[model samples]
Target chain A: MAEHAPSAKRIQSETDALIAPGHTLASITEKIASLALKRRTPLGWFVGFGISFLLLQALLYTLAVLLFKGVGVWGINVPVGWGFDIINLVWWIGIGHAGTLISAILLLLRQDWRTSINRFAEAMTLFAVACAVIFPVFHTGRPWLAAYWLFPYPNTMGLWPNFRSPLIWDVFAISTYGTVSALFWYVGLIPDMATLRDRAKSKAWKIVYGMAAMGWRGSARHWHNYESAYLLLAGLATPLVISVHTVVSLDFAAGVIPGWHATIFPPYFVAGAIYAGFAMVLTLSIPLRKAYGLEDFITMKHLENMAKVMLATGLIVAYGYTMEAFMAWYSGNPYEKFMMANRMGGPYAVFYWLLILCNVLAPNLLWIKNLRTNTTFLFLISLVVGVGMWLERFVIIPVSLHRDFLPSSWGSYAGTRYDWSAFLGTIGLFLTLFFLFIRFMPVISIFEMRTILPEGEGGEPKS
Target chain B: MRRRGTGTPDIHGVMAEFNTPHDVVEAAHRVHAQGYRKVDAYSPYPIEELSHALGFHHSPLPLLVLLGGIFGLVAVYGLQYWSAVIEYPMNIGGRPLHSWPAFVVPTFDGTILFASLTAVLGVLALNGLPEPYHPVFNVPTFALASRDKFFLCIEARDPKFDRDKTRDLLRALPGVVDVVEVEH
Candidate 1:
């Protein structure tokens, strides 16, 4: 076996260095599993969880008010029917795209850097989907009815969800995306869960971990099937991720409204989804690595690679913004031209310009090598991109809807307190779930981490 | 739990522990060459070579996933066709009842959903997992199999099994850390 050096200097190259040098398979397991198995809960976790829990309560309260008072409590009004609800729905779902991208797409590309981050990113995908589901459900005013109504269930009313409608397509896409992501995450966790089951000191934890482990014993036969299954999932998820956002964009593209109707929406929306998702991943990973003292696993290389993706996708989004304007003029349709003019200089002009600044200008700073590698700068930029993506959705939805072909129908829309409450509450819900996940589950995949170790590659050990 | 009425304890297998993946793979190759058909190896992560060493090259998981995806495509498309044309046909915007372009999105989703579900569930079913009381776990040191250590267990059910000889053969393998009997 190689000498287990604790103080070895990490390799400097970005491509070659994924995990820091000198980590043994055992050390990797100990480092990752110990976080969940540790007896003492960290104080920072309590503070973070407490704040998010409070926000979650606010979410529940907002839901209660909306359920009782109706969707009228939100800012939905004439000419601007979709308000924060749709904007947030799009934003949250878009944010989830990065998780799938990292887990599935990167794996297919044979990017070993994905190994350390895929587990938590998949978890993020699930949580973001969870947050995304709440908006459309409650936006209907009667979630109880909307629940059954959304599906093609046999009913005495003899009604079925319109197979042709983009909204119904959304029902299938988002639900399938959420379910597959969950299965992928759980399937990946089983072996690590077995590790935890074996490592748990307490009987209660042992049983809990044992059951979740599903009796995984790291058997060679199991690994054979598991690897094939995981690879096939990655294959399936690649197109599914692209299809999900495409269906989401069709929610607008399929509409006859000026700004909402564009063929560019599908690829544009998919790129923007990936762009936004990577930003959120950066937002979560930076603090997470710091808090857990996990600098070795989630190296600077990972952050730099993510920044490059953001830059590339950010440029694509910029192109998207440019195309929307050019097409508005090129199409020579009065409604399309008017929609573009209204977005740039009208009521919600501030949001449009700010989005340009955040999404276009902010990500351009990543062209600088130092800035991309800087953790603090990357985190701040990720936050900016997040806000920018939300603004992009905001500009697309209500801004475009507020003004149409007729001046008489023109009206502005704004979110009431309930709107803000619900939006922020979902953030709380996302963070709350995230905090619990980090607390209970392995933030990194222990088994996957082991694979990248020096001796993990099956060969004769160097003498 | 122990078997009743037998003076001798029920033996599951003899397991050899190794420190590195290479050692385990090498040991497994030697064991297989010795005509041990019911041998299995455990490691912290998937090693393609290790599986090949154990003579496990093909997995039925991909075929199952393909079947699952096909089922999803056919089933979802049929449901849409039946619902739209046969059950409750509504002419919205003069579009035909069989709007295949519109049906594509849901069909794609169902294909992925079913394929992914099958991949996960099928792998679990194939592995004979959720057997919490596996005989391998009877060995206390076996816990390290999920961490750093590598283990190769030749089951007693293998026709060529001779406890003392198997233990001696495993001990003779290069880099073998320890050899122990696994109890059922």
Candidate 2:
């Protein structure tokens, strides 16, 4: 027997004691099973999953009706050709931003604590992308013809997708973003799966986990391969995280839309995506830690770190808004100035205020150390920020389009019941996918977290 | 030294426990000096020096992803050009016969597709996915890997592995216990 070294003690208390060295599979399994049974399904998880499913169903029905009938089911008219659908598309895509940011950007910065939440965040990125993709495909008014958007296929229509068009850029960016994210998420799962595999007692469970682990022997060679691949993917994803949102923003920027035509759209959109993404991470993580018994693993320090990132991005988003206002005033274009005014002072003033409050003001609470570290307060603020970000998108899209050029063409567009239903349904879809993910997979990267633990003072990774 | 019924060595591999990373690095250096080639090191997190000490090699994943992305760019551009320019050249807005700029979206999309494909394929290939079995699960205590235990396997299959010598070598190192040979 190896001499027991008390070096790796995870001591929360003397009485509770550190985890015993070489704790048996039986004991771990028994603990997990007991925890699973003892712990109540978190209310947030219930609400998030339940509502997301319901909303998903409504979205499906709306899509069915839209597909069978036409895009007329949407409130899109001539000038406002992109109504709820585009807004949802942009919003969902924006929501996905935080996932990539958490998984990739933080990874590059050598922020090991990111491991605790990166897996789930990455999953969220994929699902949010799945949700985002639904809108653009349906928005085409002919979902079957989405392949047409892929290229100027050798069809009767002579138009290859206009490279000159940002919409086409979007199809590329979004699809790529979703695909790469999903890959990253799944690949990241392997080591953790091996952990689960090694931990499984039943032969059936063993087989299932064994297959997922993909014969991981924890060979130094394998680890080397795995680490390099992961780093490369992270590198690839870093650019993608920025580029995808930047391109998405260009969908508006490349056009003649006054407020959208600014040079700052790329960085601005990226910042907003990260802001929304961080808000979402908080929204999900706060409750998950309680539900999954991962508080120790995903410590308050982690939350504070995330909140700081959120606050920084929030400031950036606020700056972007300021720039837009300043640019509108400075550009001396009536339409540009008018669009800027419409965003802040027009009929969509409420939405604008909500956006500012949620994205800008709410995160400022993090400035206070106590507020940032308080899990419950952090969670509530996260939810507020999440809602605020959605409104931010709402204000950015329809509000801008609602009163475009001609006042005669301008009629205030309010979201119909269908729009609200679809939005809620999308939420349901996101939660349902999330719930399933948590139930099956270890939400934290067990392997990565071990690496992040302080070898000594200062939680610096042993490496 | 013992041999199991399966004709494999009955050594259960060395288990080195360390309090801090520096200790592990020092221990690795000592183990290396002892000329044990089959030994491995496990830690809670990756230690770059330890990885080097353990003789880690570079992964081929970056090249794979790069190629995948390049392929995507080419395929998407080619498809768009073939479909629009060569197959059905319909002039809109007095555009040129072959519009390269117009192909950027699809080309860009294809690049993403390729990159994503690489990621998935790279992961699958690197991890040896869909593998239904392995020998590590045979060790019951191995499950502690997730929570606390860091282990090293000096597999019997390694060319330098001599059950008696490897076990003797590992047993000599501080913090090492139960140097059992792992069988596949």
Candidate 3:
């Protein structure tokens, strides 16, 4: 039994080494908390933030022009009424899904590796949702009127938003998603805030963190309730995350458009959202781990696990594409067949093929063990997958809307300068928020990481 | 009852700091067994065993979340049904006014939103948080409680608490690093 014990410990250490060996609880806290506490501001942060800020200015400029010139500032018309606005909206929302999946779903599953990334990923989720809301709100033209009318508030006009409309459902899903995510993120931050408060060198810093900590004393009584509340939030967020994307997909699926009317939209869109989300996570984390020298905490095992998720979700997305093509021909619907044919061989065929290459073919490279562990390769693939997912939304929205049932109504759509600016601006907004978050908050959850220590388990440190 | 000083009790608790979670859990069990009812354990991260040692059997947060979810479902569904079928009705393609299928998404959202909000607020309320001040923070070494230290605090309010005796008992614990009195 004693000999077997050593081998068992060896296997566990090899397979499930979440944190590096030899880290005591104090070292873990100091390493993570010090990034936001003791570490001097890096020069790269300023350069990156400066570029993102300039892009944010572009986004603000675009919004100003859009408000002044009406909806015509973009390339929306009769047939392609949903252009860059809806495309970018879907793309950004899909990217936010990975964060929820990591923080909520993975936590529920007890994936210990999720601890190091969940904090920053949840931050990413909030920022991504922030970027997403801008497109649809601005696209409504009179956003003030839209805000007033879209909600079911008692008003002098005596009108209610159409409950039957998927647009109304979108409003509910997105707002709830934002609210719940904020709650979850803040709840997770409480203990870490306490840690920061205790560790801060200056009085002002202590007060700032102390207020955020809310006088968390880490009492057993409080941990009892905090654990329950956190678990419940995770349980609630799992379904909410799935529902948000499903509702977003329903915005198109509920319509009668040949390409958009499929019953598979919910699952397909959900899978694609996760795929895009993991891609975005990898894209951010690779650079983050490099910049901050967090290789000890955010280990290669974490990266490999994420890559495997991307591959699996990528395969699911590939299956969705195949099913769409198969059903188009199998159902013998001329419109569906035409939609598939047009997607594959029409004027926008390049985008369709490019998406297949990026989303499907590129991620397949991760199946190789050597490439999966290679940071540079993983980083490049993540960026490719991000672009591919954006193109998938573009292909689904505008490409499907361009050619209508009637030959006379057939037309083409292209994004104007405003459309380009709005899309790029959101990226700026996402990065800007992320930069501030990493600077001000513990990017990796400090307390949660402490729990992963071998000492936390009431056992001797292995190896 | 033995009195230490001739004034209102200025000490909050007798705090003993330990280096490891195992030591804290062991100390908590011993402290609790000695008939101290107002005992609490503090650590940088939650140790499930320590909570059990400190006699925390259950938390009411889950029930609050469940109730909040049910309330959200009923309220949102009622609003949707009332608006669509009663107050304002419009015939779009002659579809039914009570479109329950279409209402599912929003209802789900409402339930999750309300439940999550309740979970966070309920836990905070139950724990009496946003306190910004507590007697536990009065101990200088208590700062290490959020770093690497594990603490077993026997409050002055405890029936079995004797300042000198409790301090002596804490000092004798197997893995205790230091013992101090937390001020009120």
TM-score of each candidate? Answer: 0.96, 0.84, 0.96
Off by over 4 Å in 1: A1-16, A456-463, B1-9
Per-residue accuracy of model 3 over A32-126 as CA lDDT, tens digit each? 88899965788999999999999999999999998998999999998999999998889999999999999999999999999999999999999
Q: Who is ahead in TM-score, 2 or 3? A: 3
Cα deviation at A292, candidate 2, in Å, is 3.2
* DockQ (CA atoms), all models: 0.72, 0.34, 0.68
Interface RMSD of 3: 1.9
**Backbone collision tally, model 3:** 0
**Candidate ordering by DockQ (highest first):** 1, 3, 2
Interface RMSD of 2: 4.3
- The order by descending TM-score is 1, 3, 2
**Which parts of model 2 are misplaced by more than 4 Å?**
A1-51, A151-160, A456-463, B1-45, B73-90, B95-116, B123-130, B145-147, B155-167, B170-173, B181-184
True contacts kept of each: 0.91, 0.46, 0.85
Error (Å) of candidate 1 at residue B78 is 0.6
Q: Model 1, residue B32: displacement in angstroms?
A: 0.7
The window of 10 residues in a row where model 2 chain B has the poorest summed lDDT is B1-10
lDDT of 2 by residue, B20-116 (tens): 4565556677766666565666544456777677655666777888898898888877776776667666677787867787666557667766776
Note the Cα lDDT for every prediction shown: 0.91, 0.71, 0.90
iRMSD per prediction, in order: 1.8, 4.3, 1.9
Clashing residue pairs found in predicted model 3: none
